[model samples]
Target: MCGTANPCITLCAVLVGGIDGLENKLPLVAGDCQREVADLSAEERRGLRVTTKPHISIDESLREFQSDGALVRGLETPLVSAYVSIMEE
Candidate 1:
């Protein structure tokens, strides 16, 4: 895990990727997730390109928290991870 301690740092990012859902959860089996992956955000699509197995989908969600730079809501942790991007201000 990343260990950064800065009061001003306000972004929490989690890395979640796997094939066949690993031992964490079951594979999403409703809609054609991968077929539509090409149209997802650039970051979302990038995650799939690095996988070897082809039975998983990758997306991100945030926790129910607040910050000066960002806010995340995860009343219950979503099945997906979190993605954070910092832009020059």
Candidate 2:
């Protein structure tokens, strides 16, 4: 969560097409959620940021997920590293 004057950013790893049986469904859900948030005006959004990994999987371990070590890390990471990088901007 962000403070009053700062923007609120969220990092997510969208695990779609996994054994969870929600194959391809989570991406749609994520899209819908993003749309809802996008409906807000710029001022209302308050610099909101939403980062997602649409093709990730439930089978991925922490090391596997972060193997690329991209800004978009896995959920297992205590700190959403992407947030820190974006906030620095």
Give TM per candidate. Answer: 0.20, 0.19
Each model's backbone clash number? 5, 0
Candidate 1 per-residue lDDT, tens place, 5-80, comes to: 2323332322222322454486654333465543466555555543322223211112222231212232123312
Cα deviation at 80, candidate 1, in Å, is 14
**lDDT string, candidate 2, 1-89, tens digits:** 12422222222343312322353244422222354553556544544433532333322423344454432333434454443344445
Model 1 regions more than 4 Å off? 1-15, 33-85
Tell me how candidate 2 scores on lDDT. Answer: 0.37
> What TM-score does prediction 1 earn?
0.20
| Top candidate (TM-score) | 1
Q: What is the alpha-carbon lDDT for the whole of candidate 1?
A: 0.32
